[model samples]
Target chain A: MTERKREILASSQSVLKEKGYAATSVRDIAKALEMEPASLYSHFKNKEDILKITCFDMADKFELAVREVNDIYFNAEEKLRLAIKLHVEILTQNLDSAIIFIRDWRNLTGTALEQFLTKRNAYEKGFREIVQTGIDEGVFNETDKKFAALTILSSVNWIVEWYKVDGKLNAEQIADKLSNFILSGLKKEMI
Target chain B: MTERKREILASSQSVLKEKGYAATSVRDIAKALEMEPASLYSHFKNKEDILKITCFDMADKFELAVREVNDIYFNAEEKLRLAIKLHVEILTQNLDSAIIFIRDWRNLTGTALEQFLTKRNAYEKGFREIVQTGIDEGVFNETDKKFAALTILSSVNWIVEWYKVDGKLNAEQIADKLSNFILSGLKKEMI
Candidate 1:
């Protein structure tokens, strides 16, 4: 992305996080960027175009983080822990992007909506593979991989709903706790 | 509540859900009820008053549903399952109320916000008890009860963020799948 486009996306994110999707408008985005509405259209066709770009950017960042974690080729247990930690870390750092992804991504219209959904599903596929690897390696118990993925994703993805960047518990702590809880359940422990 | 007060609260909900709390005014409520704005003030002190009443009404109904589950005195496992089901059921049956609670409850000011938080915490107390009971009975492994409660609540609360009454998964199915996954994690079993 060009520096100007990046600046517009960041400002759009600031507005979206504070005012929310339905309440935000192209004029609001322009106001935040200190540009005329028509000027914004030059960098992005419209507000929806800006939103789609923002969503895709966030998704790409998340995917890259997960890929970096995957590159370690650690044991399934370690890989899962790192994956969880990286997920939380990126989300905590880019809370504005996370908020926009969680709240406003669904509002993308027509082709934009489909493209966002595709990227989201691709993002989820990484998590599914982690769970599958764990089970396949005999480190995790056998279960319905699809449901397992959904359950774990449900917990992790919803972090943005209540997670506070300045909360007492930091992202690493939460990731550790969540990883322990999930791993405990997945292992064949006789607790 | 008096009949007129109840009517006012009901009308306020529809308008709030449709137009949002920021946009919906007393005049909008009056229009919905086909009465003068002056008549609404007789039942509600102001717009915030109506919002408080509506939120409390939603919390009260949710509490009732949860309390009914508690009265059954199921084992902690069963209680946890029933609690999840009841929460989903209420969120589904009362989508408008749920939306109001999710979106507009923050508009509550001063004492109303405190009261709503107290009532909302009371609603969560049931789940905390279920988790504690499971731990005490050795059905669920002892983890951080508070964190576990928050995790479970976070997952369930986000359901409203995505659930559609007419969606592919009905409330019961979503409840069952979610409850099963959570309980699976909590229960002393292999995943």
Candidate 2:
């Protein structure tokens, strides 16, 4: 995408986050970009198209961030912490896109929705594998791997719903707090 | 609510869950109950009113379920375990209402929105205090109480999203799985 198109999506995210996808129209996205509706249409077909791109962009970011856990040193614990930190940063730093990513995802249609779900399931699998591997290495407790993964993902994914840019905890602070809380649960200790 | 009114609301929940708040109309709700739209409007001013009631009914159920944890003996760990179990039961048992509770919450307006948030915060406080007490009792690990509460709540509150009625794990099974996983995280042991 060109710099101008990226600017348009960013502006559209602001409107979508505030008014929501159900209420937002193509004209609204164009208005936010200060471009004529025809010009915006030239760049994208419609509001849903812009939303699809915006949601998928965040998905790609999530896929990229979670994959970075592979690069961390051999400690599953450290890898888990870094994964949480980077994931939280991606959402917090791109706050508007993050909000749109959750709220407008339901509005995606047909192949767009399927594509989103496919990427999402793949992203979740990547995240779950980290937890699964932790358990396999005996670094984490012997618990239901899928449930543990769901709990970890749910706790972090939920932050997108309530996180504020100027909230009490910064992204790094929340990341540490959450990772500690989750890692504590997963660590295998001698009885 | 009258028996007939309660029945109408229950029927509305099904339509709302399928079509969502924006798309599900008074006609859709009325048709689900085999009533005329005019009669449905008598019971509910519009789709939003039915939505408000649906969301709050689930909220009330959640509040009642959490309050039951207090009735158990004062083992903080037991209380926390039972809390997760009961919370999960309320959500999964009233599965449709729980779905609407999360998805359609944003559609609530004015006094209904304020009332819902007020009840929700109080309900969260109820759940948090259990974690807070567990931490003080040393049954749970020393962690940021609020962070602990959020993580605990996130793990259980999230059950509403993915739980399937026909899924392999029954309510009791999920409860045991989640509570065990969470309690393990909070148990104080040698590092």
Task: Pick the DockQ winner.
Answer: 2
What is the C-alpha local distance difference test score of each model?
0.78, 0.82
**Considering summed lDDT, which 10 consecutive residues are worst modelled in model 2 chain A?**
A66-75
* lDDT, model 2, position A176: 93
| TM-scores, one per candidate | 0.72, 0.91
Q: lDDT by residue for model 2 over A131-154, one digit each (tens)?
A: 877877888887766777778888
Candidate 2, residues B158-181: lDDT per residue as tens digits? 887788999999998999988877
lDDT of 1 at B173: 91
Best by TM-score: 2
Q: List runs of model 2 lying over 4 Å from the truth.
A: A25-39, A71-73, B30-39, B71-73
Minimal lDDT window, size 10, model 2 chain B: B18-27
Quality of candidate 2 docking, DockQ: 0.55
Clashes of each: 0, 1
lDDT of 1 by residue, B1-191 (tens): 88867666766787777756755667877888899989877776777887777788889987887788777878999998888888888888877777778776766778989999999888888778888889888899888777888788777766766677777889889888777667777888634
The Cα error of candidate 2 at residue A148, in Å, is 1.6
* Alpha carbon lDDT at A81, candidate 2: 87
Error of 2 at B24 (Å): 2.9
